[model samples]
Target: MRAPGAALEVALQAHPDDGFLLLRTARGAGGRPQDVEITWANPTALRLLGARVAPPCRASDAMPPDVVSQWVARYEKAVTGPGRSWTNGVHGSSGHDATGSLYSAAFFPADDGVVVHLRAASHVMSALARDALHDPLTDLPNRRLLDEYLGMALTRIARHRHPVGVLFCDVDNLKWVNDRLGHAAGDRLLRHVARRIRAAVRDEDFVARFGGDEFVVVVQDLPDLEAVSALAERVLAAVRGDLTLDAVSLHAGVSIGVAVATEAMTAAQVLSRADSALYRAKRQGRGRTRAFDTALSREVDRRLTLEADLRQAIERQELELAYQPLFDLSSDTLAGVEALIRWRHPSGTVRLPGSFLDVAEETGLIVPICEWVLATACTAARGWVPAAGPRFKLHLNHAACHLGDGQMTAHVQAALDSSGLDPGRVVVEVTESQVLTDFDEAHTALSALRALGVGVALDDFGTGYSSLTRLQRLPVDVVKLDGSFIEHLEHRDRDRDVVRSVIDLSHSLHAAVVGEGIETDDQQRVLRDLGCDLGQGFHLARPVGAAQVSAML
Candidate 1:
């Protein structure tokens, strides 16, 4: 019979994928095997290890630290134990090649010490490459692959002089689906939409997931602008109609923004224009397509400039809080003051929250802005004298995004602690539509706020799709009736009935009902008769500066 070392040497010499190494145990103090020395290596082992010199070198010098440590442990076990063979997988630079390839290493006891057989894992490398370029959920190309594909399409456009069309498709009502049906259903909906979108576009056209409910489709060699528009329409039609997820039927729709590449445009520029158009389509009502044009380009530029300015507006002292007083309807006494933010633009005009809040929320600038608001509002409330009314609270409206992360409670606590204001006198208000996006998360956040002795109010109630049962489940001390419900209270029976039911329900739940937007005396009278605890609007008080509010108090 052939010797084990000779057999291994003969068997692996011509092997293409396997590498073999013969190692002798290197002992230290007390005869413990501390390391190993490479006595012999096959041609494949030398190539894989990127070893420049021949064997008779220390394993530490021949392999990476991690690989050497692993091999040393296996060598000790093979030499000292029952001579049982061992096999395991490892990942590191093969030879000096730093490619970090995966390998399966098998160990066997040898006459001198141990022998190791290594096999390259080419299939695992291919899978890793595939995962890097594609979305695991939808199995579609991701943004990175999209960029490369777009680059190729742009190159084709440069060579052939044909326009490349890019469509930015955003799923509509996805937040609603996620909120009501759960995220698992939302993911199923996304996968379903992905299938429809892929089926809609031509095989040559590239479709990629661009993160969150957004997808990008690139059509190469488009003849004209009309072709882009037609493709957008096809995508819209493809993703529309009813789809069932988790046994619940949902109407699916997407808003598309179309941009045709110009000769000088880069990938980012094209995508930006398409995104701007997509926002326009969403604004114009969803399930529609809008093409990028000069008007949209100008709008995008203006928005970018505004966003940049808003970033500095806080440091420049351009942002200020306007306090609007909420009244106790029964005695016509001031119950509280709601702090509303206003931007005194450098252009000599006062901008309402409506003018720039959307931008702030989208840019994630709302967090800092809100922090500033909390500090300022708390400090202002702390300055109020006995005349401000001992029981009057300070209400501050918070964006849902600011409150969702479980950090708003800490922020509010910090503001209150710094300003030495009573948490009992503070009420944090969140809009109904915003709160419904993630009700459980909102509830947890609100519960934490309430635990701190501050009150929580569901603002703009009846504006959202939440039912009375949902309202009953929320942790709130107050419910602010949406202005729409109170707008036609004097003339519309439906509005009056809805307002009455909301107040009755709120009161039964031990929550105060505040009627908002009381423009006329009749609205206030009806609200008071319906047992609304408080009211706020232009008729009672317009939002004013801190000085004005202090003076009034």
Candidate 2:
């Protein structure tokens, strides 16, 4: 005690902003630190607390009603149980907002009673709270806090076997909101929407702000899907009402997707169904609610299973390439072939890319599948390359996400370099919409690949936004007419006109055009007449293996 007293003088001299007090106590709680007693209060405590010498010595005696009265038990447990601890609470002080931190140094055996070394820890208390559970601007529960509360709610509901529904809420036009109005207005809109939703739901319902205008509402003890849909209707009504934010009067819309938990499903599965429902809502038009459908969910589950199978298909030697010839317009000769991926199942039946490619792209299994296709096509097309005549390109379709990634250049480069095939024989076909984002990066990657003598084609043109703009910007050598635009061209003159314009536009940009999905003789004749450089479809020929391409060559 004598040694610590001498050191206390040095400690007080070196430190500022910190309130200090000497505490002593007797052992209690079975071999625990002694129950605390306060001996002296340093000048820092008085200054920090803004408390005058009011005759009482214990810091708790000066605490405010909101501080001690509200949170005494939780805070007290931390204070007296452990050796040293701290917490945030308000103090009874003027000139300040009464926020401060309290730390009990030690609970030691004392002559009279226990003492907790407390000072106004308002700043620390506020900081702890700010970090604990909120999104700064909206003051909504963040992901971390959401998980904590959800865990608690789950525990309670599980014991009672009560139902809980999770709704995945996303603002329908946040990007539009940001672009049209401004980020400041966007922030205000988000906060405003958050407040409205909180007010719309029952007090017992849990609302958490998941990232970027997305909120997850957990409605506890719900009975059925209809009840959840009703809540979604209330949310929709609240969000879609005309409102003003930052002096900009506009209507905001939201699409809510609801997933109700069942004994048959996992939490992740439930959440995924909600996400899918959300997508369905977006498709049906925003500002609507879509409840999770079992049939629709089964499709999703099947797709997920297919996605998992596809990732290993290449390594398992289950994936193979099937090429369909694209004939030249004027020459009536085979100009090139578009390589399509096929899954050769154990049952000896063939699986088309349409059945699995979307899932592959979504699950990020497309990259490796594309790699296998590239390598296999190059290896198998070696014979077809020489006799397939000049300008016989092996067009390979790549996913949009793969094209957008800067890392794709390396994968492509590696595939081409390792395949020991001439780069001129292979062409990377990407959709026009894929390169729209970060065009500079796409340009850089495409240019690097082109420098290696690889060709680039913008597949699925004339369907997405600014097709002509993309044609001009991209370093594309060809444009494949999207099948959606080309499908009904046999009789639809409007479709025929759009296709003709796209072909002419492609030629104008010094890029050749290929009309895909030409499934009838009339479509073929019209495309040939229009000078569509290359044509691919079930009408001309079905997708065949590389050996078949060699035989055709």
Candidate 3:
């Protein structure tokens, strides 16, 4: 009669899809299976084990360490039990499994010891699960897996009191490339970036694609903050280097925001801090690195709150125009007023434009806000005229963004027609810096205003890129010297010289020169000696509401 092993082997051969191996087990210390020997095996078992072996092969030699431990425990149970019955649901570990697989393992009683069987768990299902944790294009970890990795890293750091660093990377100008070169080119660029990042980092360091144009890296067991900074710089240099796509050379850069792991911080907290630093890096100018700090976080929060407040301020008509009187140096009398924007905040505090004007420009709210300023200034100018005496020129500061606006001319015309204020009484003042952004556009817009009988002044003249040649070419009627020159006119000879030269140049170009920020008697005398056409500052009169203008006049 055939032995039980032979009978089991014959039965296993009937199921070609499942693998079968007969193992001999020996008890060691603590009654555990210390050794496992392959006494017999079928062809299917040989393929599954990724091994070519005869009977009596050691289980440890054939499988991974983890798989061997599992097999030994099952072998002892099947061979030494009272019932000596077959048991199922044991699985092999990938530690020694060459197939890189999950298994449906079982053990059955045999003549010598026991028989082991394995059938690979659903291959398609396992692959699908893996795909979910990784990026399809770059094969790097996805955002979901990144969270898991970061959580585990944070836990390890907490226990060991070590540190982990997180680097948040954003690809700069990626949208421009995607729009100009096509999405296919953009995808290729991203794939190349992923490879470069992987090569630059250590083997154990984790990198992930945190969605479009963004990546996150986690460096474990950091020695110090300097090491974290060095890693960030290297990653930035690596991704920003030149690359080729479809035989065309291209370049891209990354802005990195760094956050070191803190003992009390959660995964979400760390991520948010890193994102705040990233925002700072982008704002300070791209292709830079910024570190997470309490101050930066607070500043970001304040800016966010201010942005919302400003949107409300515009809608609720909380914005008001403060008039700073301009004086004619020759007449020593009020010539006109500069309209300055002030925000009457909900907290009952008045805020200057420096606090929230940047937010307005970034959000495109400057368009509507500029329109309101023009209309309000024009309407207010009409109130002071004929009744108060002569028509005073109302000067309104203009940004380059206002000039390119399609509705700017119409807005100006409507303000003039509605207020019945002559265009000649309005002076649109633009800083030299603003005009340089699009000189041609500024020239065209200002020239159009001139045609409509409105005067254009080059504001903050000497502080910008405008030269005598360019200044002569611009269609302007006045040059407002920056406050710095007037402030230093008494102390610095260079400043006095610059002021005098500017006054002469403006006169030569048939444009009037206005000395700004005259706060002292000496500054006024110096500007007067320099023959400046107009002067405006707190020394003469601080910016006041419309009702206070009559008293100043």
State TM-scores per candidate. 0.73, 0.68, 0.60
Badly placed stretches (over 4 Å) of model 1 are 1-87, 90-142, 169-196, 209-215, 229-256, 278-291
lDDT scores in order: 0.84, 0.70, 0.81
TM-score of 3: 0.60
Residues 1-553, candidate 1: write the lDDT tens digits. 1234654655465454578778786545246655688888776677667665777777777777877777777777666665264332222222223356556666776555577776667644766889999999999999999998888778766677889889999999898789778999899999999999999999988999999999999987778778999999999999999988778888999999999985856788889888988999997878999999878888788889989999989779899999999899999987889999999999999999998988898888888998899999999999984567877999998876767787799899999999999999999999987787678878888999999999999999988888999999999999999898888899999888888898889889999999989999999999988888999999999988888877877
User: TM-score: which is higher, 1 or 3?
Assistant: 1
- Model 2: per-residue lDDT, tens digit, 1-553? 1122543444456544545555443224245432332346555555555544432333345434443332333334544564432223212222232244353232222223322333344645766887788888788789788777656665665577666687888886676568667898888788878988998899989888988978889888779788998998898898787878667777887899987764444455566778888877876867899998778888777877787677667668898777888888677787778888888876778898788887877777877777777777777766676687877888877766766456566666777777677888888887666666546667877887788788888777766576466567778888888788777877788988888888887788898888888888888788888778888888888877777777787
Error of 1 at 262 (Å): 3.4
Clashing pairs in 3: 64-96
Q: Rank by TM-score, highest first.
A: 1, 2, 3
- Arrange candidates, best lDDT first: 1, 3, 2
Candidate 3: worst 10 consecutive residues by lDDT? Answer: 88-97
Off by over 4 Å in 3: 1-164, 170-200, 203-225, 237-254, 263-271, 282-287, 304-318, 345-349, 359-371, 385-391, 398-424, 432-455, 464-477, 508-510, 550-553
Better of 1 and 3 by lDDT: 1
Question: Which regions of candidate 2 fall more than 4 Å away from where they truly are?
Answer: 1-130, 135-137, 152-162, 171-196, 199-202, 211-213, 221-223, 233-255, 262-273, 279-288, 432-453, 465-474, 483-495
